[model samples]
Target: MPPQTREVVVQKNVPATMRDGTTLFSNVYRPAEGGPYPVLLTRLPYGKDIPSYTTFLDPVRADGSGYIVVVQDVRGRFASGGEFEPFASEYEDGHDTVEWAARLPGADGRVGMFGLSYYGKTQWQAAVTKPPSLLSMVPGITWGNHLNGAQMRGGAYELGTIYSWAVTTIAPDILFRRYRDDPQQLGRKLPELVAAIDTLQAGGGYDVLPLTKLPDPDGLTPFVREGFERGVDDGWWEQLNIDGRYGNVSAVTLHIGGWYDIFLGETLRQYAAMKEVAERRGTAPPRLLVGPWTHGNFGSTLGELDFGIGSSGILLNYRGDLADYHLRFFDATLKGREEALADRPPVEVFVMGENRWRGYEEWPPPGAREEVWHLSGGGSLTREAPSGEPDAYDYDPKDPVPTLGGSILMPQIYRAGARDQSPNEERPDVLCYTSRPLEHDYTVLGPVWVRLFAASSAPDTDFVARLVDVHPDGRAIGIADGIIRASARESYPEPGVISPTAPSPIKPGEVYEYRIDLWATGNTFRAGHRIRLEVTSSSFPRWDRNLNTGESGARSSRTEVAHQRIFHDPDHPSSLTLTTVEG
Candidate 1:
């Protein structure tokens, strides 16, 4: 790090008016050096100075990072005014914030947004507003799909992570009577919080953490209470998804994500959707970069195991590349510096394990192939085409097999391809389908979907599929995973139901085709790295268990195990569809 020109930092109070007359206050980071600079703003509910990395950014220091930085206390969090509702007011305030920041004296009149977690979600909503001054964004490891995917995945709710996220991350400051400027004050208050918990348990009417259970696991966030009150996938969830409007994006996007990141799937999904729309409309798409990092892998390893060891062990120059890309992208997209970045590819993926960068004309590469591995007899995952008898096993929901590991994640589950479903084989509830390790380096890009043509004994059931990379040392690391609730089989976006009562109508003799979207990943499983696919009915704790007999199970009520089975015969060609890149 050498000496460089430094910008003067100054702070200001910027006002963002909500749809109603309420005003949200923000602390702006502007260059005291004067007239107009590019603006990189993050309007977060977290207090303006929650020290991140080495030193957290205050208005002056934050805006000093070569641009005007603005951090706001969303609605009721800090110095801001108005009742705090989760993501409810952000979309509107976000639009107002962008318009407000661009007009600031030293602002370059172009806005670029970037941040982590909630900071990430802000980009999702803000981009949709399409403010004239808003230019580009680099949404790091954030959820592209809200409700079901962010907090809930495949009808399964995350208890530890989500609750912790709410308490530590999303809880409005007013709830704890805490202030944002106190970095360690929140942690210090934990003791008092414990005491508060004790007081509430001892008959205090003021219950601090108020989270209600929704019929669907996706509806658990405090911000999403508006949706839970309505009890459906109303406009709230859809507002976060840019699926249909990908074609409208005029700004350059640099998506940063990791294999162990819970939001990795959505990150890839947004990129792919954006490209899909661009292709359909015959326009250029957003740029993507898949790094070998974790949920917070901005400047670290893939997991606890350091991928970079020794001189050769150095991971990619992530921070350097990010700053470089941001500068160049701002020039290209916001400043009309077209020729400056004419050579940049639409997609640049970092292949883990191999640890190198590769450019692609399009995602998945032009001729990337697919590997079809059929499940075989006695716990073998073979690439050999199947032409024989069906292999069957009973899946008991009550004694359901445990979910080993996979890509669908929370910050807690931070390992890449680090899972083995073999242990579950001892139980009759799980089904394992695998393939031989590669003889050479190979890449699997895009979605790893599973199409199962089978029948469930229970009228309503859910199917889960996991993609794993088995090492020679017997370490089964999870790569990607996806699941679907059976009753909702026919519909794509809507919820479906299956009765658990005795002798349900859609049963035993019938066959159904269930498509489990396993999301996407960019990994290099070296030679001798075996590919394994684990299919099971339940991943407890990670997912709310499916009670057999298709009965209505209460959120707080007792659990009921299911009796499950898988049939892979000539009549039922149950198989996995992988988007493989020939390395």
Candidate 2:
């Protein structure tokens, strides 16, 4: 840890003028006795004074560690001037803020950025502009593309997260700003909004029809409606998305993510893109750290499972805390004390089941072989191909499967991470294919996917694939999962590449091949543990339910019952592909 040799001073609501002359507010923290220290800036839509926003790194501590820290509210957010349209003004605003922060009273004109989630995204936006004074950044649990996994996944709306976040997290601020001057109006409307938020928090209101027209009577959150009305081909997403733009970022970066984070896929994509840029430019390669954590929870326990204390971000592998990791990287890059990071590895990942951290020179750890497990008759997953009768099930939109676990962002009631899948497996709609107990520890270290030859009786539908590790004690724990919308199957041409413009509806009752990307996972399936694959139609509320009517989910309330079939014949060998690493 850096020495706390200096006392810290703070200034609140400091204003910085943007290129458009709009003023944004920030809180500045600086050492009482210092001669122009390096500055660390974080811009976020969340309140600057909110403790939750600063959970990863404390600004006061950063200031005391011989640095000036500036935490700013993004435009249209708390204390900042301008209308709030998510991600629209981030690039320009972020660029302006970085330059302004560089010129702060105690700043040495060299700036580094740090924050989690949306704040992490702000760093990317600014870095893409190639801000002259920006030297380094650490973007944690953030996304590179907005549509791929941030807002929509597999061409299906992230209904649970989008609704809960907008209603509970974003609306309060919008309401506060709207009625700050009028107590009578605020009193009359605040309770109604609170009631709606409370309903959402308790896992209600998600079933409302015509998703685009949720109960926003005051029209406080127009973005929610716009998100639904806009098609994937619409140019609006370009303003917010960072796809194909990593080359524009010149700052050295450290990408941090969690196994169960909602944006894990895009986080990995961003790292790979930046790493490619670094290799081409002959600059230092970016670092990566992935833990067995969820969206904002960095603790050891997630869902029903408890990874050991070594997996905790606070005391990671008993080496240091997250703040220490950030400071050491900043010291190396911003202060030119390269020795501070000499022993750090380029890639550090927490391997679950093994419950230990592993260091690697690159991701996917080299020498991983692709292993195929075929889906066979008698509900078995085998190494050899199989010939069997197709399995069929009826899917009802009204009785969609509940969201149990995996990489999902929703209300606290719906926990995220590894959880028991026994309840879901019992449902008739879910098809389970199980492997016999493994004789040796099987380690999977890279991307996972499933290939299925199936037929549906509806014009459009959805297919979800989940990977599970079945314990000897009969516990079915979810590891990773993915979903694909039938009509929008062409959106994802490959594992990580997503072109969400085109949609081709499937022919009813005609067999079609579908590739379901389960993202990636790093786990050691211990001996005597069984590997299980689950195939289903919906993981409700996590991703919007497909109505099977070939219409937009946003504007339609109609429902349908679809009969789905899974084939496993010699010619149509449905299988699961796993990237395995040998000991």
Per TM-score, the best of the predicted structures is 2
* Stretches of model 2 off by over 4 angstroms after superposition: 1-5
Weakest ten-residue segment in model 1 by summed lDDT: 494-503
Q: Against the correct fold, how does model 1 do in TM-score? A: 0.81
Q: Give per-residue lDDT, candidate 1, residue 497.
A: 21
What does candidate 2 score on TM? 0.98
lDDT for every model?
A: 0.60, 0.89
Candidate 1's C-alpha lDDT? 0.60
lDDT of 1 by residue, 513-578 (tens): 777767666777889888877787766545555554454333223344444555565565567777
Tens-digit lDDT string for candidate 2 (1-583):
9754667788999999999999999999888995689999999888998876566888887876779999999999999999998888989999999999999887899999999888999999999998999999999999878777777887888888888888888888999899999989999899989998888778888887688868874778889988977766667887788887899998999999998999888788888998899999999999999999999989999898999998998998898999989999999999999999888888999888888899889887878888999999999999988778999898998999999978888888899999999999999999999999999999988889889889999999999999999999999999999888888778775678788666799999998888888888889999999999999999988988899988887889998999999999998999999999875
The candidate maximizing lDDT is: 2
Query: Alpha carbon lDDT of residue 341, candidate 2?
Result: 85
RMSD of each: 6.1, 1.4
**Alpha-carbon runs more than 4 Å astray in model 1:** 5-7, 12-14, 53-66, 158-161, 172-174, 177-236, 276-284, 309-321, 338-344, 387-405, 408-428, 493-509, 549-558
